[model samples]
Target: MEGRKLFAGARLRNLRQAENLTQRQFAERLGISTSYVNQLENNQRPLSAGVILALVDGFGVDIARFAADDGDRIVNDLHEALSDPIFAERRPSRQDLKIAITNTPDFAHAFLTLQRAYQAAKDRMASLDDALQHEQIDALPLPYEEVRDFFNYANNYIDWLDRGAEALATEIGLEGGNHLKLGTERLRGTHGMSVVFERGTMDPDIYRIHDPGAGRLLVNADAPRATQSFQIWQQIALAEEHDAIERILDEARFRSREARSIARIGLANYFAGAAMLPYGRFLSAARGLRHDIELLAERFGASLEQVAHRLSTLQRPGARGVPFFFLRVDRAGTITKRHSATRLQFARFGGACPLWGVHQAFERPGEIVRQLAETPDGERYISIARTITKRGTGFRAPIRRYAIALGCPVAHAPETVYSDGLAIDRAEDYDLIGSSCRICERRRCPQRSVPPIHGQISVDARVRRVVPFEIS
Candidate 1:
């Protein structure tokens, strides 16, 4: 008996074409024969569990993607096979099906075989359900947050950035990057500046451009807090070591032209932050200031967001500081930029957790609010959030709304303004809002559109809502 194959072979082929890599090159990376890679792409072969894992670990393919459309078909068929139309029908939940894929693929394979036979018997049933309209559903993309969360812990890159930022700050009076000016001899004679902007014409994405004439580049004021500080950091990175950054980003199998371009720019910025906020020096200052953002900003001549953004980038190696992540969001709860040097996961498609102080800061206007949160792993983090509103160049122009969140490990919580005995252990009762639909676990959330991955919900006719149906 045969069933629908993963179509993964087809998707791989598409990705390969977009990347412009030959089968041999792809095969070489996997340490497999070109023939094997060819056969797999042509659908003449099925992806083994080990091969799937290898693709995820080595090539950065999201394992959830492989389990999605390809695995779903198999699961649907298994359920149909296990069902008994005449009597005591047994139906497996999607969770049970997922466990089979994650922990026991061998069992999954056996179930698929049984499903094929059962489908043969149910052929009559398929014809009877004549109201069916769409038989072929386009496969949905993988859960992006899950994949990003995986990478968030892969290395100590964040610590390096934090340490590097501090180290450079200590050596260069903590105002190393601030001295740069646009289109000046101070830049040309020693450090120079360049100007660049985002693609659109209306809103400003005006950022610092790299200038060959000037010794140093100028950062853009129009960028978000993370991007602004990062550009400042990038300027610093150019003046220092360049090898490590080139090495790390070189390994990516970027999805498209856009991804590669963003990755290039993003990695360079990461290196720059690392260069400025060198671990040891920055951590010392952080402890000295007790992570007081305003004081740090004044001491370093950085903006409020600048110091906070740096506070989160402190991931060093053996002599590590508290791992922290930072994010900037607007009034509509749109996250413009985020960078993590910690275990906390950032939503790729949506905003952030609503119960956290970051979202609440919008209500306080210019005031800073300290809060705490717990992740799925039960690790607690202390977060300080505030609203930073910048006026337009003219009264005619619209004012911009923004929020900054700086967070650190719970052990360092007491030092930060966030850990004020807020009982952030578990807010199970509060609504889980501001997250990508793909990775969120809050089935009872009033904001979720699509149910979270593997979640099952039963809508009762008895209830209606002011918000979306809550998932648990």
Candidate 2:
């Protein structure tokens, strides 16, 4: 495949300015001509391979720093933000947005921050309206929202906590096989906590409970084997890695005590997943299998959701896997869990696009549904979805169902097993999807639930289509 030309004039200018070097000085450091540096900084010339090498060797600059296409991320986010109803008629063009981002990145970032604050405030107002209807207005910012924002800002990867978990896994010898037995043994030998499986002994609502007085960890027998193993690992993380987890929480400096407590649980869950799949082995296995979730689950004794969630956390600096976005949605399309190493952010207020294959996964239980999706800003992704069912204790007990979706950019599709036999190059094969209907700009979508926020609605007595009115 031919490589695309890299024209990062703004980034080059920013780097030079940060080092307090003039164009001639920067040229001298890079061993390049002043005119060539001027041309590169003005976007008249693309960054050549020799210049990149010079920049790396002469200044010891990290190559990955320049490799990031921050302009694309900024453009995508700006497009989403401007799709709001307030800018329905005065949205900026794509070229204008690119110029704004390239010429003034700081201003673009400040604009994005203001837009995020607006969205958050809008969400709070909606919640307040709902509360007013029920005559109960609680608070401004919820702890759950704070926790979600914390994870989102961190790109869903806690590097220190992940490394700590990896070290703990090495200490416990959790490598070769039978990870479940290894976890159980570690808990019993190191923590002096006996594992007990008691059916109907604990509340059906709780999956695992630790009894300090009895010196036992009680797991619900109704849970699956994978769940049982995960519960054991979670308890081990809470008991053994309490100090490390507390240090992370302290460093986080969450706004509220409740947020800190919730974050502590989240960090424990991260450690449990890391301990169960131990970074090196899991990454190697994933690459070998081309990230087949079921096969990986079978190999690692993990659930499908666990395997998918683990894939999103493989951003360990030098040993990163393919960046993926993972999401779990219930039947009503409510997103229960979300994480993105990609640019695709989930809508904060509503369900995902109805056109997405994740909604179809519920209809076909246990089957992996594959889709080629294109976002609003022309980004293409290969998405795979499968329904996961959780059985209750008794025959009459209600069963819970959820569909998990995992996706990556089309450029990375070749690295996944789900992309096999897919017509990735065919544009017609890709479904045009967006983050949400309110923000979508697709005018004539048959599955649209509501009029687009940035579209003009045209109603006529003579004409009628799938929708009640035409969007202009």
Candidate 3:
């Protein structure tokens, strides 16, 4: 196989098929003639990386997966792949590279887009690695709760999944009963297809694919059976009943199309997690365990992070449990993940302020840190964060790791074990905390690093404000 164009044609073809648009139809979507689409797909012509950008930007495929031998690595791989021998003679000049990346409409999709995340993490890690005097620092403080907040918006999907698995463990143990394999067969019998696990993937995340003509369904096989089962159920739900998911995406005051797309994907992921961890039973078990995340993990065969995450998602229309916000952030204040189903407005831009407790979850691996934060305005909430490791459980696995966090308003304290002897401050009678230093107006905030939004103008050397910021 010619190396330089490795998977480019295949990716474009896959995108066309996935969109259910004929080559002609998809070409129309890209505003390119079918001939151009043909040339690209058949390898008669190569798609500059810009075109690849258009595929993701114009359509909704996760870009991380699109340009991969598998979806696991990052942007650097895409850059390296293009430098392969296939393009030896037509070598993309530095000028070509610059224009394609910056000027090409295809690549501009990401340019105008705003996810500084992966880059931010890389920068922060590099900084920390130097400061720690190690190539890869063993640990940097993480904002696990901020990651929780990412999921909180969708009702704590992590916990929904964890709790769901736990309940299944209780009702029917997680020990391999050949049930997972057998279950897939049963669904295949009903749906007239079976799961497909493609090794050396371009996209590592689990997914389901259907072949209409052959009446076959393909599912990524890397996940645990529980995860596979959950994926199957999720695909079914969205395919059959996507009204609610569509509604949320359509309805939210999303700031950008990218955010909306991310939200839709997030919402679908949430729904699937919910179906797997049906809210009622999981919620009851959580309370039953007195919020012991470890016990919940064992019972459900889920990661500790998973159980803690679901605890925050106990929100349903009538059965509304707790109003919680979850977050996952690193020491540099970059929020890697978050969810919010409550009025808990998360900071949309900027890294979260360093003063929050979620950032500390990294320092205490496998240990839970509980904090009571009272906003400058007098609102209080309880936050809990912990480190959860993610890596290959078997030989020679890739290392993907991070921490997670959870927080809910004080009103919901009685329902959680975190309430045990937790100190609540007055004036500060609540856990004095704010979502972001940039937006928060808390003038006397001790936790404040940079003063709140208007704090800079308010400070006078003579009339220095108590919070280290000035107020007129």
Candidate whose TM-score is highest: 2
Give me the runs in candidate 1 sitting further than 4 Å from their true place: 1-178, 181-205, 210-233, 239-245, 253-257, 375-379, 420-439, 442-453, 463-472
| Model 2 ranges off by over 4 Å | 1-82, 86-139, 175-177
Q: Mind giving the per-residue lDDT tens digits that candidate 2 earns over 1-472?
A: 0266777777789789989999999999989899999999888888898998988887775555454455655676688789887886788987899888866776886786577668866766776766655554334345675677567656677766677778888886775356668877888898888888889766666788889898898888888888888888888888978998898787557767898989888988988898888888899999999999999998888899999999987876567899899999999999999888897877766889999999999889999999999987699999999999887688776688999999999999999999999999999999999888887878878888998777788899898788888888
Better of 1 and 2 by TM-score: 2
Clash numbers, per candidate: 33, 0, 46
Most lDDT-accurate candidate:
2
Ranking by TM-score: 2, 1, 3
- Write down the TM-score of every candidate: 0.56, 0.77, 0.54
TM-score of 1: 0.56
lDDT of 3: 0.56
TM-score for candidate 3, please give it: 0.54
Order the candidate numbers by lDDT, best to worst: 2, 1, 3
Q: Once superposed on the true structure, which residue ranges of model 3 sit more than 4 Å away at CA?
A: 1-186, 197-229, 242-264, 393-397, 424-431, 445-449, 456-472
